[model samples]
Target: MTPPPGWYPDPQAPHLERWWDGAVWTEHLRAPEVPGPPQPAGGVSGRAKAVALTSAAVVLVAAIVTGVAVLGEDDDGGGPATGALPTSVPSTDLPTPTPTRTTSEPPADPDAVPDVVVDELNGITLPLPDGWTPPKNVPEDDVVMTTDDGTYECPAGVGLCRHGLVLTRTVTENDEKSPETLAEQDIPDAADAAYDRDTLDRRLYGGIESHRTVKSGPVAVAGRAGYFVRWRVKTADGPGGYVQSLAFPSSVGSESPVIVRFVFDAGPDGPPLADMDRITKGIRSIGDADTGGGVGSSIGPTG
Candidate 1:
């Protein structure tokens, strides 16, 4: 960026701010007006200008793509402690808002939801993976955590993510299937929810555990209390992926022994969770085994 026709060069800024000496635009200092951008070079037609602008836009788009790709492999996406891995879920204080029957976070069609699986605890269907070989019954004091995409503290196929951590919890719930009327216990919070990586089920990726809450319209889950959710957001960085979960609480607080969920970090399905267009096209909520819900679902809200 050369300065056009300066007056004189300032003694103090000898090598720097030079000034136009005089007539022939000398390097002398004076009260000269700031020079504007140079005019376009002479061209035969205006096509060159248009082409230049288009090229600039293309370059910007390309740069974004490259940045994302590079960051995607950066493990933690350069976030806090989560740092490219999932963390542990500790017993802690969670949102204590009253649960409502809202469809703000309704589970989607089972077919559309990937990574989410269902299992049977007693007779009621529990949400688990086909391959998750648990100890059969989860303990009451057992710690819980959930994630979006990250290494699973548990086995890969289970609710645990094999990629990154998220902002949800996973509890075996002492093998007790949730009754229609839950006694309603207090949940944990961030400080209590925080757990070490070792305590978590390390999947392919490493990170922490998470928990979330919602409040909205209700959806029936196999004759039980249920709600339709707008979206499910999880982090590849374990629990406490607090950003999006605040959107709803009731739709997410289910006591099922196992709950299946899909994790999303990037793409159109991230941040506040996948949009309705993508979620409806993917998530599926199964009913009883007698119904299409199968061993995978306890009949949560359907799309």
Candidate 2:
């Protein structure tokens, strides 16, 4: 018959004890308790008394041995060490170690955001979203950037289907007129013409219906002072929408400022104005250039 589950002296080892985990002898083992010093034998008359004291001593030692074995029990629920431990030696107390915090930084997410487009012209730079791309050729004075793969559009085959977002920059010499005055005068004219490129290429044609100013105020772009104007335009070909334009003087005192316009015709779902503002703020002037602000140019009323 198999022995019951318990700690027992190992038959294979001379002095070490092993745990018989009910079915098998486990690897857990401990050295047997060290034998104590021999006691001196008493005289013949005192022999009887000596024997009685010896019996009591054995009982006391047995109790101590059992306690030492139980104390060796593993906290992990594993079997206790098999051998008897010396009762005379004290157990060492150890401090529990605290866990450490990791300081390594996490890697950047590759697919978290879309790519960006940077447009540089006339020494000024503008950062646009990924969809915006440069056309093969636009008007010499104006740098036009458009989004070709945009999901937003008007019905196909219509008279004025929106071709995604359109950003146009018109660099003109300072004509002494304030930015607000120039925008107020130019926007109405462009809207009155219906933004017809063939009829008025340089001036924006707002269509037959007309374009009205929605809001206008002072603003700053890339740390340069500027004026911002919002417009509402309607056309016969498609639903009417809003246009945002920002014009700022490139240099102080008699220097012409650049006019940047953002036009998108969305019927109900309009462009996110906050995001547009962020894009506008990204505008930076790399350096000054001779933009050749000539008379009757697109920058002023003459064009």
Candidate 3:
């Protein structure tokens, strides 16, 4: 009798099993299943052993057929075997990954103010007049424009000095917010810093001898209401100079008050007093494009 379709030990390859299509061996093959413990061969003839082995093989094949039928019933009928895993199935429940982004500030335009000194902290720009340029060796945050005549021996015999100096800085330590009040309060210190004495208490401008208010009034600066206090200072040894403190609210940031201090030697060599008015008129916000005369323009004493 012919055997039913099932996996059986391959006649050509004893280590593996081949498929029998109920009549002949098919090409499919698989590893043989693990064998049971050895049966006792004592007192058994070779023929009898063969008969027993044939019967056991038939039983095993029938059991394998039953297992396959059960698996087919559990799976989608005539589809893949039960419990088989797919190669690559995408999941709908998981979130897709997103890429990260970065940002930065834009670069400043070089052509915006080609001939000015920009003070970024105070959000203002000071125009460099024909005979003036930015001073070297000054603090990074302190903005100063001075006469191109450069540094010279101080008449007071203390340190190097510039004949004309215009310095700008933000007022952070003071509690006063009024532009007029702050301007008035800053003039004395501005004079002292420029003419009276150095940080080492050494005399400057031969030590300021006497100072009288030359200009004091409400004014407009950089399109904002402001005030300035200018003084004609007398020094002990060299030509005396003028010192002025101008205060205004910043156009950018937290709108903090800003102070600009001006110092000019009192002689034929010092920067012209008219330059003071020119610089004052030229004061503007960092990015302002207006070239017209500044608001509330005022010219200082020429002599």
* Error at 248, model 3, angstroms: 0.5
Q: Which candidate has the top score in TM-score?
A: 3
> How many backbone collisions does model 1 have?
105
> What TM-score goes with each of the models?
0.25, 0.46, 0.58
lDDT of each: 0.32, 0.52, 0.73
After superposition, which runs of candidate 3 have C-alpha atoms over 4 Å from their true positions?
1-114, 139-141, 291-303
Give the winner by lDDT.
3
Residue 146, candidate 3: C-alpha displacement in angstroms: 1.3
| Candidate 1 local lDDT, 129-244, one digit each (tens) | 32222222232122122333323343223343222122323434454344211112212222122221333433322333443444223333433343333232343443323222
- Candidate 1 local accuracy as lDDT? 0.32
Backbone clash numbers for all candidates listed: 105, 7, 0
**Per-prediction RMSD in angstroms?**
26.3, 15.3, 21.2
Rank candidates by lDDT, best first.
3, 2, 1
Model 3, position 11: C-alpha lDDT score: 43
Model 3 residue 297 CA deviation in Å:
7.8
**Deviation (Å) of 188 in candidate 2:** 4.3
Worst 10 residues of 1 by lDDT: 242-251
